[model samples]
Target: MIETPASIVADRKSVYGLRTYISLFSSAGIGCYGFKLEGFQCIASVELLEKRLKIQRYNNKCTLDSGYICGDMTQEETHNAILREYDLWHNAFGIKELDVLIATPPCQGMSVANHKKGNELKRNSLVVESITMVKRLKPRFFIFENVRAFLRSICTDVDGVDKSIESAIDSNLSGDYNILYKVVNFKDYGCPSSRTRTLVIGVRKDQLEVTPYDIFPDKQPEKTLRETIGHL
Candidate 1:
């Protein structure tokens, strides 16, 4: 069953409820903050570095009901591990209903700074793995993020077929997903730094498509660096 925002707020008023989430490159679980504040609880996450996962557990007070997988996301083992968790959820009568899946595959290969080696950097193709996982999981919502350079970068795949990153993503994730993306700067949302990124959101056709502006409504009263850092 698809959950509308009203139902989510109504049902999760007392507890975070069972809206599931899985984050890739979870990075100490910080990315879930906004969603968590809105009452979505993470069920699992994957991060490559053990130190980061340990820090995540520490920050969450070691009380998370979520599972964390620390491993190279490009590897099949990582995929299988996540699948097993989902299967367990289903067997436990949880419906395996993943409300959201957010990922930030490593961006180094797509960064212009890495062009010193030409854009065919091996890690550039790792995004295909994330796309493949989305195909398998069929989450209600998914967002893939990376450096802004990712939007125009071209790189060869494992099959030696060179394609634009956007094309590759479309080809790989073709289906009910309505893909939306924009180059957005966090400063517009009162962030202290002018961090810009390419954020791609994929919603199943049945789900309402949302934009960066829809996500961050308070872009004005325009924050100044002085206001942001005055305490520190």
Candidate 2:
């Protein structure tokens, strides 16, 4: 269920109630938003970094209701364990389906900062792992976020030549899901950060609506970094 502005404000207390099952993968930004929405109550979360796991537990007060799995998602055993632990296969939540799945795979390979180096090779396979998890979880909605440079990364085609990132996503999720991609700047969304991110939202074809992009604000007030900084 996509949340509306009025509902976000009026039903803030129960906003998470609408989402009984949520899976967050290698998510740091979501953790920030989770605090605001009390998203620690999500059914399951997975993080590979120990420091990040510590922070998640501390911030969430080690909540027992939600399960946190710490391991590399590239491993099949880890992936299978997450499925069994979350009971996603059995639909134990009684909703008959998982609500949402969010993933922000390591972006170093797709980041401009790694230019000229072979960091791309290091992080290339993680993208496939992320997509694999999405295919297995089969959530109602899935969101993937990454750096703008990701749009430039090339994927090897059958001809052994490079193809655009859009082509890569199209080949991976075309018939199984309908994907909407957008490049957004935080400043344009009234956030102080000049941070720009590429967000890809995937909805099963059966769930297509009149406007898949209508969920976000069309226009937002601009905000400056000064307005967001605190003085010491």
Candidate 3:
């Protein structure tokens, strides 16, 4: 299960029994974070911009045509369209399972620099679009990534009650997923840059054995820019 994703485009001999992934807010398929890698087969991807979709297609070295959708994920039509895609797969494969959902919604609403003194912008609530998809698709695991400020950003729920973004996710997904999150500096993981962000993961309660702590990668020795990219 720790294997890197073998190309799903290859014969089933390589990717058989692997998890299926659907990416939301996917931009050019490069910032997939980790969902489109080994052990996971990216079955579908959605982006708001058509240009990004083209970039994704052009840069796609991985297998699978990657069913792509261009639309606002927060809309009902988008949800219905994705559901229809899943329905078609189920009818053809005889099993209904979308193993993982990864979403990195726009961070303007939750960025610390955006509002130094005011409440978090309502725009941050777009994460709820992903939460709704989880409720509908019932994926075994979900990945939510955003700026570190997302942990403190607040939003209004259907009841109009003020809630932190974390609370909103918990309120929506805790029923099925045991959510966990950590603020990580990717540089510690050997990335050349010092990009820090909040990574939230949800493992379905039934999959308790794969805890949140287990999902994140261990910190590797730091690599300086010279060692990482000086040659370039």
Candidate 4:
């Protein structure tokens, strides 16, 4: 059972069900929230930073068995290595599909450091690749985390070039994917950071009825930084 705070900040139970295999991408091996799921196990994790991977491996040592894959996700060799380690392949891992995939691609393009350079060729290309992976994996559910600028940037296309992120993703995926895009704040979800992120959730359309949003409503009051920091 989840420990009850004075009030529920986010109803995780509504979002994820019991006993799931989760794949975390480009983050510190599946942030604290993933641990909150009652039976959710992070079977596979990917991180680019060596230091962050070390920290994640150490902290989540007991929870994660195979260890986190440290490298870029876009590289074919890196992706193959991760799949092999996780036994994601048919007959080998005995696992056919994953339950959930959570990715926080680099937000540098949308970050304040980039000053609205979200449309950079490299950044946009990475985002496209991330989406393509989603179509290939076809997990029951997926969560994409990016800076707020992601929602604001206008997609572009060169002559005969399909540069739109959504277009690239759609071309790869079947027509049955249902996606929900929203801008969320960590503060409102009981985190101390004032970070605001654009989240895109994709699920097979037939499964949309089971989506967790109904159980977890938006518009929850923000938990002040002071309230969170005091506990630390």
Candidate 5:
């Protein structure tokens, strides 16, 4: 059954000592809902569309009004807003650092489903923004999720050199983070649908107790769509 906002609020666990996260390109806030379920509190979320951001607000995705930001990631305004909000949230909790950064950049340009994939779309370069934020925020852990083609997709890096997304990530963050880039189907990870996605996960070097492999989901028996929703 679909959960309502009130139900979610009632069921919400106290996050006093839990990890904190901020999301970039958080469309409708569904993707980060999983993180909330995992006991992480959202410090802030950025979505370009006001309509989509409203949905996030309606769902109470972030505890503070300032936490829901509507702005373009490419702009300096958005970056500053994120930093300001993160600092306020971080200071309020007296946390040493942000625990996680979850980014799901627009994937239309890199998705195999896009038949018109020819020259790289401008949106593809948005991955660079995700990379830039990771470097700036230096979260203890970070996650990037997109279509399976994302790794091979080309994007201009911070240095303005064109490179595959995989190479860009490796060149920029490998030195500071123990990173893992992998493509896996969600069905293998216990999701109902057979959705394949590329996941890039990073653990800051100082966070030595755990590696990306330690946090990656273990494979599980696949579930069919019929089995998942047939009752409805």
Candidate 6:
């Protein structure tokens, strides 16, 4: 069934008291929809394309106009805009910290399905922008999602040194956060179709009660391709 913005908003009426979150590279709101459904209130979301942002807005991913940002993640202006929205949330909610940050950077360069996979693909470096935000905003929990090869992919770090994406994340955040990286099939986690992806989860050091292992869900019964899409 297709879900309308009104339906989503009505169903999520109780979410105002839940943990607040923000999204980066939130293309059409697909990646963050699960978070929203789980009662995480998305206060701000950024997408580079206006068309995609329009879809997100229609879905009510962020109800506030200031929270729906459409701009280049690599640009300083875009970063400032996101930060401004974060500040607004702090003031509106009377809180100094964000609950969660969900970022799914473009995976074309890191995906095995891409025939043109190489360091020449500038999109691969966009993960650095996500990492930069973690440093600046310091959300209590952060999630980075991408293709299974994300950690193995090479990208220039904040220090301008070529390093694996895993190393860059560790070098930048391991000190302040307890992080874990895992590769899993979405089918094993109750998704209808099979999808292999990498997930990097980080919990701020101060959030000692919850570890990455506690956040990652246990495996579920696998679903077959035919079982998932046979009707179509």
Alpha-carbon local distance difference test for all models: 0.71, 0.61, 0.75, 0.58, 0.86, 0.85
Question: For every candidate structure, what is the RMSD over all alpha carbons to the true structure, in angstroms?
Answer: 5.2, 6.1, 4.6, 7.2, 4.9, 4.8
Ranked candidates (TM-score, high to low)? 5, 6, 3, 1, 2, 4
When summed lDDT is taken over every stretch of 10 residues in candidate 2, the lowest stretch is 1-10
lDDT of 6: 0.85
**Prediction 6 TM-score vs. true:** 0.87
Best by lDDT: 5
Give me the runs in candidate 6 sitting further than 4 Å from their true place.
Answer: 1-18, 118-121, 223-232
Q: Higher lDDT: candidate 3 or 6?
A: 6
> 2 or 6, which is superior by TM-score?
6
What is the C-alpha lDDT profile of model 6 across 19-135, one tens digit per residue?
A: 678899999998889887776767789998899988987887784667889889999999999898877666655456888999999989887788975564478789999999999
- Residues 59-160, model 3: lDDT tens digits: 662234536788898788888877866675566443458788889888877775665545445677777788788888998889988888877787765456
**Model 1 residue 31 lDDT score:** 58
- Show the colliding residue pairs in model 2: none
Better of 1 and 4 by TM-score: 1
TM-score of 5: 0.89
In candidate 5, stretches whose alpha carbon ends up further than 4 angstroms from where it belongs are 1-16, 226-232
Regions of candidate 1 where Cα sits further than 4 Å from its true position: 1-17, 61-66, 114-120, 155-160, 208-220, 224-232
**Model 2 C-alpha RMSD to native:** 6.1
lDDT of 1: 0.71
| Candidate order, lDDT descending | 5, 6, 3, 1, 2, 4
What candidate 4 gets wrong by more than 4 Å, as runs, is 1-18, 30-37, 61-65, 88-96, 116-119, 152-162, 215-219
lDDT for 223 (candidate 4): 74
Counting clashing residue pairs in each candidate, in order, gives 0, 0, 3, 0, 0, 0
